[model samples]
Target: MMEERKIGRKTDLRVLKTQKAIKDAFKEMVMEMDASQITVKELSERAQIHRKTFYLHYTTIEALFEDIMKDLFQEYCRLIEQTAPDAPFDEVNRVFFTFMSRQEPYMERMVCAPSYRDFSDKLFMTMMIHNRSRYNPYANYSKEEQNVINTFLCLTSVNIYRQWVKDGKVLSLEDLIELTNRLFLHGISDVRHDL
Candidate 1:
């Protein structure tokens, strides 16, 4: 029993290490060039893993990209869970704030590097973008309205994040969350009226 447990743990660690290696390599290549231009051979070389191994893990480059996105989102969710135990909006904001705080240095590096201009955006778009018809919140809305809402909501979130990063505001995660929730629940006119 003890030997089996030890083997399982070791196998888990090895799998994690390999996954990390692939992700890091992919990030490096993405920084160097367009994601569409990256090939599995290139990824395998950068990751220092065998081509067969890459194929074994991911059926295609798109699959690998999907995996990367899933990992990033999982990390963000984990951060949320770790930083906010209360499950309230404010607490959720704190979690977001902590996650953003951790990402500050990475964003700085990405900005200074110049080569990674659209990498972050691509990652965000990959994770967040969905067909209007598939949007969960828009299930009740008409098709045309759903399309508009989907586009508006996506653009709004992306713009806010871009502006926040560009302005270097690093606003309190809590404030950001509160503002986001408020804006989401109430229109600009409503906010103005409240003020």
Candidate 2:
């Protein structure tokens, strides 16, 4: 069983607003410089909040980065859940690509920035943790094997997405989704598994 922490509605609203401001500031700052270059002082100044208030919400910039990743992962899970259980690969891919397309600029900056490579790696690991069950069909394999497979798949997907963003998304959303699905499902194997 899990314990729930309760807070007054007013306090909850204030916390949410402050967190959003901090995130917005971070995003804006990332566009200008690397995450490593973003100091708490600068972030607080950009967010128009005191440095102590930032500390109250997050212990460090890395914590804030993790929180942002958590938000994205949750949003992705929500979108995936909304998809029908029997949804075809194309449908699921459409949903995912649509979400990614909307967040393209921010994602591109985050992934391409050298200083944030560690953060990107951590984000991928976090996503893999959240998605492990979805990839666990080969029950005969050991946990380590399953983890290796999952990590490979996740890294491949991330690289493809990074490439798409780097290319300025020349392909239409639907086309990109189809391309990604086809590549992942078939992988030049010539075997046509109806994904």
Tens digit of per-residue lDDT, candidate 2, span 35-137: 7689999999999999999999999999998888777788878887776655665665577668767774666678656777787777766765655545435
lDDT of 1 by residue, 2-109 (tens): 999999999999888888888788777766675567898988998999999888788998787667656656676556445323354445434544554466443434
Worst 10 residues of 2 by lDDT: 1-10
The C-alpha stretches of model 2 lying farther than 4 A from their native spots are 1-7, 84-94, 189-195
lDDT (Cα atoms) of all candidates against the true structure = 0.62, 0.76
Q: What CA root-mean-square deviation does each model show from the true structure? A: 6.1, 5.6
- For model 1, the superposed segments whose C-alpha errors exceed 4 Å read 1-6, 79-101, 104-151, 167-186, 189-195
Per-model TM-score, in order, reads 0.58, 0.80
